[model samples]
Target: MKEAAKGLVPASSSVNEGAAPLVERLIAAATELRIGVERLENGVTVLDGGIAVCGSVAAGIAIGEICMGGLGRVRLTTSGGAGAAEGGWPTWLEVASAQPVLACLASQYAGWSLSASKEEGGGKKFFSLGSGPARALAAREALFDELRYRDHAASGVLVLEVDRMPPPVVVDKVLRDCELAPEQLTLILTPTSSLAGSTQVVARVLEVALHKAHELGFPLADVIDGDARAPLPAPSPDAGVAMGRTNDAILYGGQVHLTVAGGDEAARDLARRLPSSNSRDYGRSFADVFRDYDYDFYRIDPALFAPAEVWVSSLESGRTWHAGGIDMALLRRLWLDEA
Candidate 1:
């Protein structure tokens, strides 16, 4: 998609190497972060954020940073005034990245689909969209071909949002594809129904915006910087409910600001087209949409995968364009406990 920009822009850093230390740091603070760390017999390190242990918001924040390949910032903040009251959400995740294209699309986009079925020799079925720095090492997605970026590192980490540990065959696949020894690899699991998992998913607000812009035919190289915020939803016990809340947090309440180097008209058009509201399937909760579609994500509209609102600022024109609006009433109805 960004074939032209591939030749024009060079990757500024190795995502794997940048995030390796962050992974170590997260491990070092695991106890305090309320996460579980285990080493497999073959020496692969596994960090469990929510599957077997109680994972906290702090762990999610650290994992979110690692998912960006250490090129982005993810932190918690709070909103104020009537809007916060109406939305019934006060706490939010504030995300920012100076290297928007690389930090988001190249590392945090969850483009690598990894799976191991029972027929594939794993006793149980396993499937997940792998995210984080390990994706750079694998470079399995065609998106990497368009970006023309690869990472060379002695160690790598992958973050998977799953309830169960990956099968041995799946682990072996990652080791082989990433060209890393068992001892040099780490796998972090964050289930969607857990606190840490929900937080980390909501932290992808800015990355989602960047991805949608690319889908909309915006020049990725032109996007210089980006920042976004989305409410931190209460994790639900039901897997479907949890997934819906995380997605709706961004689709209904998320806001994004992108700094681009382009003409004012281009920026304005991007602003007009970048919100989830523009989708034909926009008004309903994502859970309801997912249910109506028989739980198949591919059947849903791709255009609906965007923030609630957006602002695009043209660096050359010194003017900003804005579009869309947040649906706090819908968010409140879905998220609030009126009892």
Candidate 2:
């Protein structure tokens, strides 16, 4: 019988033993795909952390789990999957008990929001903000300070969602920031266009809502659980097109439900403010905005990065406030354009 690579985390573990750090699980996934790990020189390497470079539906599930920082459970579900197999299965993720703020908002989704870009050694040097628990160890972003959370560990694992691999200098900075040797660091690479990549990106629906809540002064600590769904688009040959379609999944079709304990008014206001549609950059596909900005992410409006709709149910008051709705017309337009 074919089995997962040895030493990988079993599907079952003692709950009393404490959950493993998300980065460790990510590395296990990398080890499972060691043949798919592409080693680069200069003490830096590029590796397939989850599914192989060209991944599978199961791999997409694993990737979604990684995106939740492993605090959340990601699974393939048939919800809204009627005619949904446009080449990929549907997925859902849920999180509770762990640090959702640190796991998803700071460590996972918020890391690469505005990454560093530079040129060194006479060649272009670019580093997407590293994701996963390693970002907590690096504490490289203002979001880390705002959250007062950081991870201290011997190993620094980073997940980068980019079409290009990191150059040596980019690798060096992470090593220094996390105070780890080159050999102690691992980078999991997933481009925005691949099947795994798209699944993982749509997987951020919950994080998007949480981050926006934080931005709106909602007490994120009160958010006890979260789950979300977004349509899975088919893989595309063009990375840009794939990226656009995936963002559309979130901006147009994604729906996030968060359970929290803030007052109904606060929850309502936060929910009211938390959708991509609230941004002035709404109505147009993300591809259109990317093209208008010449593909520079920073140049685009930051407010536009959020789920299409958010539903917040207050645990204390037992009240739910919902805002926004799916943009099916816009979603279909993007899909037909891609087709």
Best by TM-score: 1
What is each predicted model's overall lDDT from 0 to 1? 0.89, 0.64
Model 1: how far residue 213 lies from native, Å? 0.6
Candidate 2 clashing pairs?
Answer: none
What shift in Å separates residue 323 of candidate 2 from its native position after superposition?
Answer: 1.3
lDDT of 2 by residue, 121-237 (tens): 236546565666567667778876666566665565567876666666667777788787777676767776676677667777767777777877776556666777776676677
TM-score for each candidate, following the candidate numbering: 0.95, 0.80
lDDT of 1 at 179: 99
lDDT of 1 by residue, 242-330 (tens): 99999999998889999988678889999999999999999999999999999999999999999999999987878998898888889
- Model 2 TM: 0.80
Cα RMSD (angstroms) for every candidate in the order listed: 2.5, 7.8
Off by over 4 Å in 1: 1-9, 80-82, 85-87
* Positional deviation of residue 184's Cα in model 1 after best superposition, in angstroms: 1.0
